[model samples]
Target: MQSEKLYSDLKPLLLSLAYHTLGSVTDAEDIVQEVFLTWEEKPPQQVRDVKSYLCRSVHNRCVDFIRSSSRKREAYVGTWLPEPVNTDKFQKNDPLAEMVWKESLSTAGLLLLQQLSATERIVFLLHEVFRYRFDEIAEIVDKSTANCRQIFHRAKKGIGPLPDRNPEIIEKKAAFAERFAEALTTGNIGLLIELLSSDTVLYTDGGGKVKAALRPIKGSEKIIRYFIGIKDEIPAGTRYETSEINGMPGIRLVVGEMIFAVITFHYLRDQLSDLFVVMNPDKLSHFNRMK
Candidate 1:
């Protein structure tokens, strides 16, 4: 196949798979470019089953990246969050697109995927999201079909508590996020506590470079207080808006020329369950590019 045609045809699928699996647009784009380079350099006669070949290549690259990333994660300064990707450029313009987009890229779902081992994560993402059969995944991950099945099941069990990445919840979350921003901006502790679930957990990933909680802050009261305590320090020009983040309703903060932070809210039953605040500059470096 012509290199240009080949890349054009597979880039979207590869990007979607890579972004969904790794949750990093920079990494995904890099890996996809590498695949294109390799395809161009290889002899055409060696190529067969283009779809499978591309998928397997990207899959292996993502797994390798994840394995390496896990080590860095251990030494990571504070809470770690999946790198958020802007979906507007790539998501299909259609009615069901929102639902499909969330299923493919919800931050909460991606965070839950971290519970699984690398192998299990690969199996679950391939089998559950991409709809790849066990046999097909076996070739991609180089595991036996039976082993893949076991891993997928284990991944599911580990991720059991996470609610489904349902689009129907978007409406509720949108309201909750607006409420959250209002509370945080105005330092309304009572309303903040009221909006948050009793068991709500707040995770901040400052990557040790910024001042943030080193560990998760649990419960509604503590979380509300945590925000209220910092209200005075939030810089001038800081603005918060409800935006599509990681393919779901989330908050985007901007201060002056820089993109300050991206916060993904996880909610259940109209109550906010978890908040993932990604403040790591390294992680947010690519934020402006995507916007």
Candidate 2:
């Protein structure tokens, strides 16, 4: 009973850690279940640091899972993207948890993680997202603390620096988002084109499970054409509702009771620079309740 209670108490931490490491809630839950099963079979007689033990166990399991799953993931057609997370469902008290949620929820951050090697991704998440000490993460990844720090530094350098935003720019992003949605829904391609910069780019990730652009659509004219074309392709009765995604205003597509997609807008100054449309059903699970 005591052991069962302990497992229950650690469940959230385990889930959060695994999810950050694996980028998939389903896989994270599976790893947590495996941990509980292992504990049941061979109970720990003494755990001086229960949290550390569980963290290490979960990290090891994630590494193994990543290694084994890489081949299958590489074969995935179209642009493979990380699963999207809904921030409203997660606990907000812990600073680390909040940061993890923010970083993981952002489309750009998630895309960057997908570009990293497994080791680099894990190191980056632990150090940058979770703020884990180098000494502690070294044990998790079986590296010297200095080596771990170097790995993290290299990873950070590879990803480049984040864009600086001012309050005025943020306000402009919101305003543009509202206007862009109205333009899209009303099929006002000219308005949309005007709002977008000349060098605007759009990326759509459907994971090849659904129909989406295989590559990014570049140029304002081409992007306008693509959005205009989508009006007819969407099923009848489908509706779009605007909402905040990763702290930016975006739209969600719903078909009856089911949420079919999410679109996030990236702004450069007052003009729309990049648009991301995520249409993969698996990726849309987080938006299930949004409708």
Candidate 3:
């Protein structure tokens, strides 16, 4: 009973760490569940700190999972994108809301995390996103405190600086999303072009399960044309609903009550920058609530 209570309380932090590290919601949940089972097998009294012990277990599992899945990731079709997790359901009292800033949960942010090696990713996330001290992270990663600091610094330099989380900037992003969605649904070509940056790019991930652009569509003009061309291709009953995906404003392309595609945008300054479209059925499976 004590173990169960501890697991329930720590589930949010565990999930946040795993999800941010792996960028896969499904796998994160699986890893956390595995950790819970392991916890159940051991007496809570045997653990020095339940939170630290569980976090270490999750981190180790993520490392193993990443090493094992590298081959599959390399062979993945087209551009591989992280599975988007809707954040609108997060309540004020949710632990995840405190553990991860909205910027850390952004799809763009997760993509940046992918550039990091497994150990670097875990160390960076622990220190940057979860605010763990070097000593705490050293113990979790089973490395010396100095080694962990070096790893964190290396990862930080690789990832550059974190995104701006100013409230005003956040509001601008929200407003931009609303305008962009209106322009898209209304087929306002002029407005769309004006909203997009000159070097705008669109990346689509279909996982070879469905048809999608095999390469990124670059330039504002090309992207505009692509959008125009696809306007007629949308299924008759398809409807779009704006929702918060991975902490950013995103659109869900639903056909007959099924969410088939998700679109997320990244900003360069105040202009609309990169756009990510996920049409892979496998990635969208976790969005069963859409039905």
Question: Which predicted model would earn the best lDDT?
Answer: 3
Stretches > 4 Å off in candidate 1: 92-102, 161-168
> Model 2 over residues 158-257: C-alpha lDDT tens digits?
7655433355765667678778878877888778878999898888889888999988889998988887777788888877776656545677777888
The predicted structure with the larger lDDT, 1 or 3, is: 3
Which residue pairs collide in model 2, if any?
Answer: none
**Against the hidden true structure, what lDDT does model 2 obtain?**
0.74
Clashing pairs in 1: none
> lDDT of candidate 3 vs native?
0.83
Instruction: Give the per-residue lDDT of model 3 (tens digit) for 85-181.
Output: 7776563446555445354557777888888877888899888877889999888889999999999999888777666668787678878888887
Clashes of each: 0, 0, 0
Relative to the true structure, candidate 1 reaches a TM of 0.88
Residue 245, candidate 2: how far off, in angstroms? Answer: 3.3
| Candidate 3 clash pair list | none
Give the TM-scores of the predictions, in the order they appear: 0.88, 0.83, 0.92
Ranking by lDDT: 3, 1, 2
Candidate 2 at 246: error in angstroms? 4.2
